[model samples]
Target: MENIAKVCSRLIFLSVICLFFAQAIIADKPDFKYSFGCLDKGDYTSNSTYKANLNHLLSTLTSNTEIDYGFYNSSYGRDPDKVYAIGLCRGDVKPDECRSCLYNTTNFLIQHCPNQKEAMRQDEYCILRYSFCNIFGIMDDDPVYTQHNVNDQSGNLDTYNQDLRTLLDGLRNQAAAGGSLRKLAEAKSTGINNKTQYTLVQCTPDLSQTDCSDCLLSAFGQIPLCCDGKIGAVIFTPSCNFRYEEHTFFGPVADVAPPSTNTSVADIAPPSINTSAAKGNDGNKSQTVIIVGSIIAFVVVVVLIIISCIYLRVRKPREKSESKLINWFIVKKV
Candidate 1:
């Protein structure tokens, strides 16, 4: 019995130590939120000029100090070897963080997709993509990616969905009406349980108002299919994305003054999407921490429960044997 108790105590102590280390690990290295899509379009030879142009273009794409608006579009080389790229940072991201996010994305694409002529990557804060053809000013919605919270809301889901839709619709309009510099909007609304539904919608600034609206609409339509009843969800497409959460998940947005009324939308220099960059926010990190912590905590609890059950089972038999011995002694004495 003593041995069993000691063993159980050791196990419980070890489990606690493991739980502490697990949480430390998670805090030290938060899981980065990102997705990669390596298109089957085509591949370039290692020594080909296309590869050289791609290397040169991506290497220097974020080095330009002049572009602080978080939208970058440029082409390198000419003809068949020309590589077009676009990088877009979240509107709320600072210029330096935006550049850093994009720089990391460029490295990611090159490392992960390697020889693919067309590839795209979306980080929590930014997106980076490249192609052989002119992807400029064109809205591509395919190859969509969606992520939702694992936990569901407790209140009436019908009311929650309706509130979410209303919030997204308003944000979509606000983002679409933005000028060529930026097309992004964020707002919050009260939902069931009085939980605040925070939402953000964004489109590449190069897109026309109509194009931006259409792209966001397509993304919104995907919510019912992908995230019904979930407390949080995000849908990503090539042209646009929308995210909603029960808690605040975005940073303070900078005030962007409206463009001059005389400036024609067509006259604005069209920003293109080829290779772009955005930085991650604290919301993604917190979400990752919560999810990881919950899983680790649950595992630890289960292990402790099992250990406790074994200890109780082992102690019960010893107690029964001692009781029998005491009764036998009393009878013999009598």
Candidate 2:
């Protein structure tokens, strides 16, 4: 149980960090393109047919876009049609990270669950799940985790809850109304505690608006489990997910306007620092300084070694001559 807890903490830790860091980039920065995926793993018996079919289905799920996904046929020889699976990457993750994550999750799920037909793996940038039953189009929020920071409530929890409700409702509307390829909603509001809380609510494009709202609503309730009085938390389910925190978690949206990095004022740096790209010889000079400093230090060490050897050679002979003079003086005194 302790090991499992540790594993859960470590595995789920990245999802939390990603949510926090997403806000690190200035909104003015260009947004990058990405893809997403989802799956429902239903329970199944040990011996079952469709084993070959399951393998084929998984193989047919060719990886694509910024999101790469695959289903590994688990049964080595036995045909178990009883197995079902799905893999979804974040809409903003790079294709390379998505691919590596998919590959890792596939291998991990097999090792962690063994022959079990029902299992799920939620990661920092993607999700992987498999079961025997068909779960598409259905909304599931139960058995999910909603977590937040641990701090004293500034005012009443109810007031903050109401604020969250109003803001999330607007975000929900906006996200559900997203395009066919992506569905995401994020907004911020000032709570009674004089703190700014940002909430991000989203779902896989495959799910209906009803499913998305229902999932977000249900996840809202689970926030007490992992994040009761904290600043933020993430409640993720098989199909939909939501997160709320005081800090920004998602990076600025990538510029969709064709190979452009700078286009608008909002693409400028954040309030804290200047984020412009380094230019010309100044940056190059700094790099050269580092290299030149290292080489000079090496040469100085070699020169010091030669000087020390020369001093030692000269000093050793002088010391020997003094010793012989002392012996002659001792003999004359006798």
Candidate 3:
């Protein structure tokens, strides 16, 4: 009975660890709660054509040479049986990771919303959406989702909020202006009590600068509705997405160290001049000056020698000519 009890205790501990690990993994990735809208545009059996088109489109997205830039949009099949799809990977995600994320997203959509003419699925690293309607170049914010960390921010809430806004605003501008291929930006800032806040913003590359900006601004506007003073939060939409965390979430590149704004004058002040240390420094300086002077003097001496040689060489020719002239004069006198 004791042995059985010990075995059960170990099993319970393993189960607890597994549960924690699963939750951690989920926290790192974006959330996809459910499909936005589902409908049967055609017979459920005939929808195989639509599924084929979707498969082809998704495969093309990851396999395309341009997919590395992390944005792909295309339409497949004909109207009434056609599917328009868009895939966007996080700016910092690797090509392989982007592909994997997109693959999983497509599968998730198909499994959860089968035979639906329109569906959207979002994962941590990427977002994939398909519809019978045109989804390219147009900005859509419908089906917006918001999530926040359970922990409330510590310290002065006002300062934390301000810093968070500033950081996210800067990132939003950068991401909106990222150009035709990619519009994504990430940044970090020190908030209250020296806590660091990280932020990331991204939009589909097809949107114009103005459109991207507007899309992101709309998402930012929802912050108050979802994650006012939370330590972490994410706002996801079909056109744009942004997230913030007390801990770095996107990647190591976004984990920037906060500037030393709190540094005191004493921190950067020059060290006190101990007499002995000062004397040693002076000695080193003198040695450096002496060495520089010796080098200059040697260079001057070498230049002088070269000038003297050149001068003598020219003078020697003149002297030889003069001597020949004198000899010629003597010969004439003879």
Candidate 4:
């Protein structure tokens, strides 16, 4: 019994230690998924001039100095071998993540879309596109790729979709009207069941306002075809991309409050007092609350695991002893 108790205790301790290390490993890694479009305009040979242009363009896009605004566009080589590539990162993505995303995407494009004259890849944090023709300052919405969460919306989907559309429309206009260096917008809205929906809209910075708007609108038109009735979805294309989900998936940025909708102005009114000075204070309070809540949750989980370990250790021996007793009785009778 003493030996079993020691072994069980060691096993439990090792399990808890393993769980901590596993969680740490998972937290350090970023989960990224990407989709790409490859144009069949023409194929290049392994050692062709086009491949050289593509390599040069990708390197330029991912250069350390060119990632400040998280958008880069450049052309390489000449004539038919020329490759025009564009890299655009989500507005709220950190500079390091932006660079990593672009670099990973470049490698993916080369490997998966090999020998293609035109190819584009879209990840959650960034986009990478390369083409033989002039892709700069132009909007191309064709050949879109749409993805949606597997879960369907509950409650009134009409109300949910209406709120989603309104939120995305405002973000679309705001993003398209952005300055030349960056065209991106993120916002949130309250929908049915008091759920918060976060939406991100973005276009390549090289596109003109009109072109960007048109491209986004075209992408929006496909929501019904791909994302209607879903709780979350992403519509991606070479020119633009839009995403929305119930959870706040992005870090804090210059996000606009949702427009005053069917509710009264008083419902959304600001406090009469000057709260600007308290904004930092309020942020600190929120952070403190989150930290405290996390600690509480962690403690609860640890306690539950310990209880489980004790219960298993106590019960396992009883079951084993009962099985041995039954076996011994049967052998004596035989």
Model 1, 16-61: lDDT tens digits are 7877777664544323368999899999999999999999989888
- lDDT against the true structure, per candidate, is 0.80, 0.54, 0.69, 0.74
**Model 2: lDDT of residue 186:** 65
lDDT of 2 by residue, 125-191 (tens): 6666656665444566645744444444567888776777788788877777664334677666687
Give the CA lDDT, 0 to 100, for residue 118 in model 1: 96
Estimated TM-score for each candidate: 0.72, 0.55, 0.63, 0.69
Q: Output the TM-score of candidate 1.
A: 0.72
**Candidate 1 at 293: error in angstroms?**
12
What tens-digit string does per-residue lDDT give for candidate 3 at 130-195?
887777788988778887887788888888778787887788788887755568887777778887
Whole-model lDDT for model 3 versus the true structure?
0.69
Model 4 spans > 4 angstroms off: 1-32, 64-66, 254-334
- List the candidates ranked by lDDT, beginning with the highest: 1, 4, 3, 2
Q: After superposition, how far is residue 184 of candidate 2 from its true place, in Å?
A: 1.6
- By TM-score, rank the candidates, best first: 1, 4, 3, 2
